[model samples]
Target: MANSTAKKNILNKIKQALDTPVPLPFELNNEAVNVFQPAKEELEIIFAEAFTKLQGKFIFCADENELHAQLQLLISSKEWMKIFCNEDQWNVLYSNTLNLESCDAAITGCEYLVARTGTIVMSAAQQSGRTVSVYAPIHICIAFTNQLVYDIKDALQFFKEKYIAIPSLITFASGPSRTADIEKTLVTGVHGPKEVYLFLVDKTA
Candidate 1:
C-alpha cells in the first residue's frame, strides 16, 4: 500500500511538471558562418575524405574519354543489362542503349558538391527526378571539379545566384540511406538506394 502511494505521488509530480511550460535555456541565432574558405584542391581532398567515411564510392575521371571508359567498364563488370541516365546527359552515355524504365542504375548530375559536409546538392529541375535518384538500386552521380564548393553556405549562395526561383524540391544527399532505429542494428538501403557512386570529372581537361 505504501509503495503504491509513492508511485502515485511520482506520477502526479511528473504530470505537474509536464503541465508547466518552460522557456528555452538559450536563444537561437540566425547568423551565418563565414570563416572557412577552402581552395579547390583542399575542397576535393576534404570532400573525398568525408564521403569515404560515409561509405560512398568516389571515382575520378581526368577527361571525357576516361569518364566514358570508366562508366563502360563499370557497367560491363556489373553485368547490368541496361543503365538509366537523365536525358540531358544522353551525350555523355552514348553507349547506353536502354530506356530508363528497364535500367538497374541511374546516372545524373548534381547542382553543387558541398566539401565541408560531403553532400551533393540536387534539385527537381534535373531530369532525374526524386523517383529515379532514390528508387533505383544503384545511383551514380556525375559531378565536375568546378562544381565543388567549400561548404553548404557556398552551395546555397550559388543556388541563390543561379536560380530566379527556388526549385520545388532540393536534395542534399550525403550518402546512401541507413537506418539504426530497430535494436540499433545498422541497415543500409532501408529508405533509398543501396549503393551510391560519385564520378568526379575534370571538366578543365
Candidate 2:
C-alpha cells in the first residue's frame, strides 16, 4: 500500500513539472526583425564565402573597365566561339556579334543576389529566362552590388517593393546542378549548367 502511494506521488510530481510554463527561447517578432536587418558589408562577405564554398565562382569588379576585362578573360579562357545572351542584356553589355543558336555559354542579369544562402534570384522576364540559364553548359550572371540582399525573405520583399507585377516564375540558383545518385558519389551538371559564375560589380565605384 505504501509503495503504491509513493508511485502515485512520483507520477504527480512529474506531471506538475511538465505542466509548468517555461519561457520561450526568444520573442518571434524581434528575432525576425534581427534576421531581416543585415549590413551591406556583412552581406557581401558572407555571400562570397558561402558561394565560394559551393564551388561557384565569384568575381568582383570595381568599375566598367575591370568588368569588361574580366569578361574578356573568361571568354578567352573558355574558348567560347559564340555566346548566347538575352537581346536586351547584349545591347546593354556587349556588341551584337554572337548569334543565339551557336553560343556555347549564356550570360544573363539577375534580379537579386541572396547573401545568407549564396543564391541568385532570377525571374522569367529577365534576359536569361528559364531555359537559357538551365540548358546552357555554363551560366554566368552579372549583378550590381546594390542587388545584394540579406536573405531569401529580404529578396522577396525587395521584389515586392520594386515591381508592381511579379514575373510568372522566380528561380533561386545556389550552385551548379548536382546529384549524388549512385553509391552516394556526387556528380554536377547533370540537370543544369556545369559551371556557375557571378560577376558582382560594385556600383558604388
Candidate 3:
C-alpha cells in the first residue's frame, strides 16, 4: 500500500510536469478580483501609479505584433540593448529578442497572471532562462488581462487542471526578490532583481 501511494505521488508529479495547460473553468469577474471591470477604470489608475514607480524602466510586450506603441519608450532607452524572446518580432520596434548574454537587466512574459496580490507565475524554459527572471537587477513581466486570475489558489488550480506539461521548473514571484536576512537590515538588489515590474494589458473585447 505504501509503495502504491508513493508510486501514485510520483505519477501525479510527472503528469503535472508533462500536462498541457488546461483552460480554467471559472470565469474572471469582479466577484473574483473585486476590481475587475469591463473598462478597467480603476485598474488603469493603478497601472499609472505602479508604472511610474518602475526604475530603469523596461518593457515586456504582450503584443509584439506592432499593435502597441507604449513600448516605444523602453525600446528607445539608451541603456536598452536588446530583448530576448523565443520568437522574432521584426518591425514592431526593430527588435531582435534573442541571444541574451546576461540576465543583468532583462524582461520576459508570464503565462498565468494573479490579480489578487499582483503575482505572476513563470515556468522556466529555453526562451526564458531560469535565471533571467530572478537573477537580474530588475525584472519586468507582461501579461494580458484575460490571463489574470483572482489569486494563487485559482492559479494553482488552473495549473493542476490544465497545464500538466512537465515544466522543467516553476516559480511564483510576488514583487521583487527580497529578504531581511542580514541583521534585519532591509536591502534591495540582493539575491535577485532589486525590483520587479508587472504590466497588465487587457484585450479590447
C-alpha lDDT of residue 140 in model 1: 86
Query: Candidate 3: what lDDT?
Result: 0.59
TM-score each candidate. Answer: 0.78, 0.77, 0.59
* Collision count for each candidate, in order: 0, 0, 14
Q: After TM-score superposition, what is the CA distance of residue 26 in candidate 3 from its true location, in Å?
A: 29
Candidate 1 or 2, higher lDDT?
2
Q: What's the lDDT for residue 173 in model 1?
A: 89
Better of 1 and 3 by lDDT: 1
TM-score of 3: 0.59
Which residue ranges in model 1 land beyond 4 Å of their true spot? 1-41, 91-102
Per-residue lDDT tens digits for candidate 3, residues 47-106, read 334444433232334454422465545446536566544423222333355445553346
- The lDDT per prediction is 0.81, 0.82, 0.59
User: What is the per-residue lDDT of model 1 for residues 1-205, given as tens digits with 9 covering 90 to 100?
Assistant: 9999999999999999889967779876656646665454767788898787888889889986888899888878998766777557653554264465567788888999988888988998787777777877888888999999888888888888998997889899888888999899999898888788988988764
Clashing pairs in 2: none
Badly placed stretches (over 4 Å) of model 2 are: 1-41, 91-102
